[model samples]
Target: MAFGSVVERNVQRPLMRLISMGGAPILQQLHLEERLLRRTSDNWCIVNDGTAPPTIVMGVSGKVSELVEVEPVLRDNVPVVRRFSGGGTVIVDQGTVFVTFICNKTAVTGLQPFPRDIMSWTGQLYDYAFSHRKFGGNAQSITKDRWVHHTSFLWDYDVKNMNYLKNPKRAPEYRLARNHTDFLCRMNEYMPSRSVFTEGLIAALSEHFTIQQTGPETALSHDNDFEPSTKLLSPQDLQDIISSKESSTVQRVPGWPQS
Candidate 1:
């Protein structure tokens, strides 16, 4: 179908708010996502956040003992935060670039508010936005009437930071038992610069919505009422997890040797 028909049939003059949040803590970013999903209504939003300092971010359902090596994390005093969204764990730093999309159910015609559907939609959008160095990965949070889709672009990274994460018992098959360095690639190695990639994303978005550039303050001005379920684990919290017998159970692979 033509772009005109898509606009006419689904959304007429759909407006999207674009906000750039530079170097925010992983917890703050998750809070922002929650606020947008709860307080806003019938609006589309995009947030670009550059992470500062290295921190471990995990899915809402993730368990510390299952996903992280607690000893190094405690020794180095690294922050470990679980987001409100359901996705795998990651160690993000200054080198990670984040883009988030918050949208109403009907913001995009023919787009369903399910995980796979949103992933496929974003996968196509980035294909248009970053032909050279596409987004590194994505995750989703969906509600009855709204959904949030976010992607992280790995511009560069410290290999040492990867050691904080344990090899997850359940991972995508494509990972093929490879270590972090082998599984992931740096965007700077393939694409020009971060600015160029950002420009490309904005240009691609123009094809979908009438975007208005806004500041983070504007997005946060509404009365705050949302409470996030996820929390950042303190050193004490990590120790408690280690001591708890209810920590996630380990599953052995059928052919793998057991300890």
Candidate 2:
């Protein structure tokens, strides 16, 4: 088969590989690096086992008011950061395993735009990971940006637990409190643990793509070398960071019809 044909056969198909990643902040930074890498390399893929220290990450469009319980989260010393991609806010603990695919948009082969081909592709990967289990996974468009497909594996996703965290009545300033309430309440109950899902995704991607399991040594080499531009936040700095972006517009990816 031709190269393109081979890649097309692999799209949404299963592949297995081993990957390890550091804490949540490091993984978030790596996501930024992968975004930059898409501008250059083709054929490269990344699967990160981002099982990290406890942290809360808000999506690019997520309202801080909605995405975090500031007083408690801060008191717990868990860092809250924003990702370049738009999606639902998520909490990453040691139990969560994060992964990402880094390849040139031109090398994406059979997948088309947004929800259709991309969603199918991810669904296949999830299927391979959760193989005989009751866990569930899904994909959605968060933005027009290429190079990354944003997803999460819910290990023990409980409606009551999610509701306790996302209660609208708890925050009057939240914009889509009602929407969040409905979304969490209606979520599936079969969420699997991060490790199980990560293992499955790696296997699926390795079978389908040209898989390369990376270590911290390899991952660090790809790091963006920006200096310590900002100081470790003092209480005032934290307040400023929150205030500066409070009124900013949250970017959203255009949704497409299913394939």
Candidate 3:
């Protein structure tokens, strides 16, 4: 389905709460997605300029041993976080930009709440927003009534950070076995500045929603009482995964081997 049709099908454009969490910590940004998806019924679109510190974020079903170079990350004390969403593992720093959409199943009239459809819908949106730019990666977490679609755009990157992630056992055919440096491109090379890119994204988004501006905290219903399941893993946690040698039940992203 086309991106425009996702919204045009509805007689009234759905209200989307927009928040920009500039340079928030990866874990907190992740927790917010869970809160917005589970506690609230309204649609949301969150943008993060970058993560506070360098961190490796994995999907719910991601295997740290397979996707990350665990020893160096553990030795350097780099935070390793597993999000509630399902996607490939990514190591992000101040150079990465994040855009996430959390919506009710009813938000889009006929769009199916499946990963591929949501991704296709977003792909078209980006194509309209910045036709020349490329995305870092995207993943989706869908439930009976809601779904969150998030993507990373590499504004700039530190080569050293790429050392933290290993080549996936299965990768997209387009990768062609290129090393991290060759596989990823910096958005700054294409756009003048982060601000300019963001402005364009907002403009594209305006085509779909009324674009209500909101504080990230306003979306939370029980800030103090709620505990997040997605967290930055500790030394013992990594050790346990290493020791067990068991596989994960969570499904891998497309292009990744199922087993």
The numbered model that scores best in lDDT is: 3
Q: Please give the CA lDDT of all the candidate structures.
A: 0.75, 0.45, 0.79
Identify the runs in model 1 with alpha carbons over 4 angstroms from their true place.
Answer: 1-11, 127-135, 245-259
| Model 2: per-residue Cα lDDT at residue 24 | 38
**TM-score of structure candidate 2:** 0.59
lDDT of 2 by residue, 1-108 (tens): 001122455356432223455553544544544444444343344444444555555555556655555544444455665555555556555434455554444445
Give candidate 2 regions above 4 Å deviation. 1-19, 22-39, 43-45, 127-145, 156-196, 223-259
In candidate 1, how many Å is residue 83 off? 0.6
lDDT of 3: 0.79
> Model 3 off-target regions past 4 Å?
1-11, 127-134, 222-224, 240-259
Please say which candidate is ahead in lDDT: 1 or 3. Answer: 3
Q: Spell out the clash pairs found in candidate 1.
A: none
Q: In model 3, what is the error at residue 159, expressed in angstroms?
A: 0.8
TM-score, cand. 3: 0.85
Q: What would the per-residue lDDT of candidate 3 be over residues 17-64, giving only the tens digit for each residue?
A: 999988999899889888888878889999999987899999999888
Q: Which window of ten consecutive residues has the lowest lDDT sum in model 2? A: 250-259
lDDT of 1 by residue, 1-259 (tens): 0111123435565788888777877778778778888788846555555676698999889888989988678767888998888888888888888888999998877888999888766665564123333337677889889999877778888989989999889987777787777787787776778877777777667667888988777877766666777688866677666556445453322332334
